[model samples]
Target: MSYQSDINPRHSTWRKVRHTLSIVSHEPANLLGALLLMLFSWIILAPVMSVLLNAVLVQSGDEGRTGATEGTFTAWYLLRTLTSRMSELLLWTPLLNTLAVALSTVAMALIVGVALAWLINRTDIAGRKWFATLLIVPFMLPSWTFALAWSTIFKNHAIGGQPGWLEAMGIQTPNWMAYGYFPIVTIMVLHYAPLVILIVGNALKRMDSQMEECARVLGASRGIIAFKIIIPLVRPALLSSALLIFADCIGEFALPYILGLPVHFDTLSTGLYRAISTRQSGVAAVIATVIMLMGMLTLMLDMKMLREAKRFVTLGGKGVMERRRTLGRWRTAAAALPLLFVLLGVVIPLLTLFLSTVMILPGRFTAENFTFDYWIGHNLDTVALHNGILLTPEFWHTVWNTLVIVGSASIACGVLGLLVGYAVMRCHFRWVAAFLRQLTFLPYLVPGIAFATAFLSLFAVARGPVPALYGTPLILILALIAEKMPYASRSGIAAMTQLGKEAEEAARIAGAGWFARIRRIVIPIQAAPLATGILLPFISGIKGVSLFVILATPATDVMTTWSLRLIDYNYQQAANAVVLMIALISWAGTVIIQKITGTGLADGLEK
Candidate 1:
């Protein structure tokens, strides 16, 4: 109150306005950045607004029942979603399962990933580099790949499918082991653990080892050192990995759909997918909003943990080198453990898929049962599909669709990301910079299916200036651009942070305009990261299913959707072959990008 009373209040409104305008006008880039930021905020917020609106507004049938006109606001959806008899099954149970899976995944990923991080970064283990490289292979593969592999091995005839490999080998797998939470959690762990590994491994690699040696000289026990010193030091990485894994698993749909649908076990993502498919738009909106809120809350918690962790920073101006731990007899065991994980996560799953692709009947290894029909043979007998995937027009159509959609989306993401990085790093206004940064990250936190549904609601009908985009490839591209912006933006920001403004400033002094400066100076300097940003999303999009699954129509089928359709018709061999092809394509794209950029996937991931 005292400060407020003492503050000068003599500035005229006109003067304030002129001052602000002058500040912006002096730097055209600032003006352009501000406008772009506002436009991007509108783009990102549109679907979210639509989701909120859809949740409250009554549809035609609902309006008829409630004696209200269509699109009129009503509490009926909220009442039903929150208080109805079906609420338990519709909302609470799925929410609980989602939390459980997210928590369990965090626990599993941290244990395996952190241990591996320690082993690779701090120990004299054999094949450390090989383990470090191979462990992340599963991350590149789609999560559903693991789900398919799991089903190929452990599936039973309990639900009227062909017996799995275990059954073929005369070992009966329980339904619990084959599907639902167990398999879902396991598959997610394998898929996401690599993220944890990369983050924690990088932290451990950069850590100063002198502190540990000092603790050892101080007569600290190994247990004491681990709990009192090591744990506290790596806590930031541990918490970060946990936050990422939790956020990802909560939004994950493919594994839950493939593994949970048969047994009627639903997570938030699968539930949202079913709601949208069944045309329960209002219910779907509510679920999506809830998931978005959960993501925000988790992100907030991550921020809080990060703030606390900042107090424990170990890096300093002093040069410190990490010393490897001598494992002696335990070295072989440590190396074997990582190799075993690679075998379990990478080798086994891929082998299962390849074997299934060749098998006339999935899970049967008999020579007479093996065939190339799914891969190359013509005139193959299947449901709607009549030939090998390689021989089908449908396959080529999907390949074309994939290239067009993913390529366009990748370019959009890369350009937009570069602009965002430029604005956030170079802008003078604090609030505008912060807003743009957070807004760009919004899509990554929202569940893919929920985000797709939001897209459907917002774009299904033409409103005002925006035209209808539903069922079009444009919608798919837009959705992908939104969902993948986080990756591209982060890459751009990291690259840009390393670039000095001196060259750009000099270009400006020499009478270069904003666009010219960016084109000639910024783009050339940050080309590697720009390439990585574009290519990472392109690789991810090539095999992506969850984000586009809700949006793809028959005419718009990509490889993943095509494989899911094949699976639906019980064409296991064709489906497996399609999945294998997708893996190869993604791998090839990653390699090509790395080669072109002179940066490996591991290097990019570590950044």
Candidate 2:
């Protein structure tokens, strides 16, 4: 008899029920795992439900304002948003503006990313390796890393009090070009291009050369082979990169906050933020729901693409990889382009920051303008002057808090992600698996502000020992963990899938303990993925200021918060300095992890 049948008596309805209960009762790990999973799922799902329900219904006072009955189930909310008074300001115009900015951003990003990918992966560019290392600098920081850069160079006295680089040098920069759509698009593109670069770079490296050779043998020209073969093969990467940029841009906050508001430009995030602050939370939630719908639609589109993707899977291990294409005369031009983009996008911003932090005066270029006062001084001449971040004990405390929160959450998510991946991939419980998968992945659909609000509502007041964690470091950690777990766990599952079961079976044959086998074999072999899992969250956590912005207190502030404080105080120089510091720290961490683990930032999604 098989082990399953021999261990049980004849099954009856009550007996079966009792047996299942007993099995579950005996398995502490599984039971505990399920409970944690369910709790987290509830936390994520309930907020989304609140926003969705509120979006379609007539919000309190909304009906009275519109001369309709209160608490009615009319489609007025959707109608007004799509057609009535605020449609131009709140819906159609803002929507079009968002599309224009997002598309322009996408175009600029693709141009930069694809070009760099080709140079680093396919061509014998002079500094291919160094370029690869530095390419992710923009991604590790907030998308607004270069906003300060743009302002420092082209403010034109329209926003910033003093002249920027252009105006100082007798250039009368256009106000629109300096502040609104142009600067916003440029910064976003520079920030997100690295994602495309990483994905496309990996695709280029893994692409088998024989397919291109076959195309050539069929009398296809180099341009034709390149277009028909190379581009088609990497379409998955391109599409994936494009969709992420779109989803992120649609709900973006920080960039619009910095660049859009100065010129009277408004996108959904900035517009919604204003509404929430004015206690029009109902309307803000409505905007949140709109963005959520867009996210779901894009996710569906990606799924459809994956399902219908044909003629795109020519990757195989049978051919010798081709020699790198020699750039020759074009090498200088190719190398210059990526370097120039990085210089404008990364180096210029950083240089501007260095200038600002060291300068005692905002715009002067003398050594007397430099000071360590901002870095280390205590008890300066104002009520807001707490102390320098470098000198204050509080600064180190916040650093510790940030790391503790980010690290604990990441490890927890990584472990849960492995379990999730394994259950979804290997188990035959289809409906359960599907439901659970969707439940866990649902947050990717919800906007960060909406998610934060839901969490605040749930945890702000004391409900037993689950005490009010609002503005507490614990809440920040919990939120970050919940958000980043899906990514790490999916990576774990991907890595595990590539590994066969033979090793585990062989260990079992030798009568080795399950724990021993897992510790000695499974973990060692899966090291790369587990490492990748942790690395992704760390980088994301460092840049994730906006999600924490509304929720964090001074006691719980991180580097991003510090930058916001500087900006709020109108200390642009200091703000840029801090922003640069955070970006460099994140970028350095990303580069270090990639070097140590041989994994790319996009490995989780791209694979």
Candidate 3:
């Protein structure tokens, strides 16, 4: 009897272990969710924590200044950044400038974007399809493209290098026009307005026309109907777009660097860059922390707006009726508005950029002055450029690095996103699934520059078995993957949600293993979204500058960084050439992706 009691206790414990293992083994998604949770915690959560820690700790460079041991906790850095004499120059002024630029940009972008969205989606405007495609072109290119173009045309001899087109033409451009707040806001609005169009347009498209017709039946004027009904109906999208634009403007690096730097018009991003360059790691950490907090706040507000949007649902059990408003006598005028924006935003900037690349002198339009030296020449001694960008081995090498690194990261992001989606949708534990989803999205709450700063702080030195990634291409790939996780994961989740489980269930019943089911069923079914997950990141990475600026070494330079280097060298023509190439590549990539998937950039903005 004693022997049987001891054996029974042991046997019960073994059975419980076996049962738990069986459950884990049968549910591969749960296992995957757990694994992904750990991986993301290490990559995403750890870096953010590192940023916070570095902010509070006495960094190596600041130890002597703070009179503290290195790695010890100190609030001296925070105090200096916020309360010291230089705090106004270092933090407060930049914060105010960032806020000013962000608010102005959002307001202007809303006006332009909402107007275009209404014209294209709600009105019977001419070339709606063509206008829609054309409007989104500005977004595909780097945000700095317009800034460079602005400089190419309006630059003066304020800081002195090559004169701008206006100066070359004996038309002295004012510093205010060429740089500082006005140009910064104008260029940012041009760049970010397309985002507004996409988001608001999606909402407009999904809304029922019955509401508008009812408003008209009540004898409401067009203006009254628009202000009271249309605007309110799309308020959620407007709020979300405003917050997103504000966040983007807050973190913008290259635009401010190009246009604002000469005039000493500092914003938080530029200030952070200056801090890091000066090796004030603690100050930089503090600034990065602030930027991250702002981003998180924006994300929270965006989520709140999204949740509140449920209360304003336009869809019902009945089929949606979408009717475009007839422009009547104003059709041509309405069409002309979008065309005008395209000219200012796309056509003119591109033309100005192309012209600058071809001409030796900024404003000169002479045959002898125009040359292809920037594109193909071997000897360029005047500007100190050894060879044309197309002929330079460094340029080619950088292009290759961009393709390999960004491409690999994008592929990884897509695959991991799909896996994340699969695990989130299919995991056994609801809390685990929710955790994995939120963790993957945490990266989106961080700005690119701040996120790069975090990665630099965390990965500059080896942690345990991981080697130092400070100057390596591996760090760039990892950062790109993490930075882009939100887009990829969202794509993955949306695709998977639309897909029913019947096929996978049938495969499981037929004795198909998890890997086999994913390979034979899930992947094939969600190929388009999977492709979208890859291509979106690839395009964004190709045009990206802020993320790579701090992290990329000379050997690991991408096209965007290469262009920035050229600018530093005062190789204006060569820089414009590189920027043009980047824009072309991004545009072509977008076109190809849309062609293959039959999905436009605006399609993703739909709720």
Per-prediction TM-score: 0.93, 0.85, 0.95
Go through the candidates in order and give each one's C-alpha lDDT: 0.83, 0.72, 0.90
The top-ranked prediction according to lDDT is 3
Q: What's the lDDT for residue 200 in model 2? A: 77
Models ranked on lDDT: 3, 1, 2
> Residue 176 in candidate 2 has what lDDT?
86
TM-score, cand. 2 vs. native: 0.85
lDDT of 1 at 523: 90
Model 1, residue 172: C-alpha shift (Å): 2.7
RMSD of 1: 3.6
Best-to-worst ranking by TM-score = 3, 1, 2
RMSD of each: 3.6, 5.2, 3.0
326-360 in candidate 2: lDDT tens per residue? 88988877788778877876777778877766666
Candidate 3 accuracy as lDDT: 0.90
TM-score of 3: 0.95
Estimate, for each residue in 1-607, the C-alpha lDDT of model 3 and write its tens digit: 3554456787899998899788779889889999999988988999999999999999986777899999999999899999999999999999999999999999999999999998888888888878888888888778899999999999998987899988988999888999999999999999899999999998888788898899899999989988888888899999999998988887899998999989999999999999999998899999999999999999889999999988877856568887888888888878888898899899999998898988977788989999988899877876457888899998999999999999999999999999999999988789998988999999888988899999999999988999999899999999999999999999998888888889988999999998899999999999999999999899999999888999999989999999999888788889999999999999988987999799777563332
lDDT of 1 at 584: 94
Candidate 1 has a TM-score of 0.93
Positional deviation of residue 269's Cα in model 1 after best superposition, in angstroms: 0.9
How far is 497's C-alpha from truth in model 1 (Å)? 3.5
